[model samples]
Target: MDKPTISKNPTKKVASADHKNLSSIAQYLKDAQGSHKRSIPPLDQWQPKHCGTIDLKVLANGEWWHEGQLIKRQAMIDLFATVLWKEDDTFYLKTPVEQIEIEVEDEPLFVNQVDQIDIEGKTYLQLKSTTQDLIIVDAEHPIFMRPFKDELRPYVHVRFGINAVIQRAAFLHLVEMGELSENAQGETVLSLKSGDLDLHLGT
Candidate 1:
């Protein structure tokens, strides 16, 4: 009876285990591919921001104006970027993009004004308020106006880059539209081409 004992077969058990592992691996690969296919490009990725009528106005005047009110200052208007923040301790003469809350004579007043221009035959119907004492900021100033630090922390400089890209797109659009022409002093003059007049409004 001792000589009749037989060893148990382990081959079948090993083969079954290996088959499951291989199937699991294949499934994992399939899942990975599916995830990759469904992923979307990040917002900071290089892309063009299309220009609208407002952008055209900015390109024309180097600033965005509404109803004779300055919606955004020219220097603050980046042909290639957005303002992240205004540098502290510097005399940022340019208008701030953020909505400011001010208390005037114990009454809170928001100083946000819109700049509108009605298009009429390639020219603009301009209507704006008087800006007699407004001080314009120089574009060549040493002070840097960046976006809010907290809002763009982990991705330092990305916001600025994105803004710059958008501005460049707008400029390119203006050039393609034949709205930009070279001047005698090598400066760019943004004006409507002949026979393409439209209404314009600026701050």
Candidate 2:
């Protein structure tokens, strides 16, 4: 098998031509957020199945039986895990909320976090960084300590791709409810009666 080419110094080019399109993409994200509601079903309730493991040959060729070129199995699994599905067969790589989860050590911790938020005060937490360490948590380890140490045991971990989608959707939903704004510079500027806080990228 040929080792996949890894580029170390890829060129950095500004996408000046697609600024308007990028703005539209941003708007789409905001719209998805605005349209989202808390009443949506949770991940476990949705019953998303593992759908069985698929090999790289089948994925790249869209056929069940093929002896075509093969990529590393790990790389293929990573690619498949990041993909999003629109219909039963249509697949893309964007994030969606139905697949996301917010995990806490206990119900009390979850409640405390929520209670810390002031009434009518907006709070933001970045799912990406919070779940980054758990991306590869060994299920055989204790859930609470898995984030800090590499242990072997079955543990529960949140799906970050889904979380990112949900957070973005929620933020945009607030804006549509007249709670936030996007400035001309394409920055998501939010407003609250109590005052506004510029949300840090990962927070």
Candidate 1 whole-model C-alpha lDDT, 0 to 1: 0.24
* Candidate 2 Cα lDDT to native: 0.27
The deviation in Å at residue 190 for candidate 1 is 3.2
Give residue 136's lDDT in candidate 1 (0 to 100): 14
Error of 2 at 131 (Å): 12
The per-model lDDT (C-alpha) reads 0.24, 0.27
How far residue 67's Cα lies from its native spot in candidate 1, in Å, is 41
Stretches of candidate 2 off by over 4 Å are 1-24, 32-142, 147-156, 160-203
Candidate 1 wrong stretches, greater than 4 Å: 1-166, 186-188, 192-203
- Error (Å) of candidate 1 at residue 61 is 23
Top-TM-score structure, candidate number: 2
Residue-by-residue lDDT tens digits, candidate 2, 110-159: 00010112334553322221112222212321112112134211122344
TM-score, model 1 to reference: 0.18
Q: Output candidate 1 Cα RMSD.
A: 27.0
Compared with the true structure, what per-residue lDDT tens digits does model 1 show for residues 1-203?
12211123443122233222323433443453354232212323333232111111122212333223444543222311121111232111111211111111110111112122334434321111112111111221111223332321100012222111112333333334445556667764544222233311110
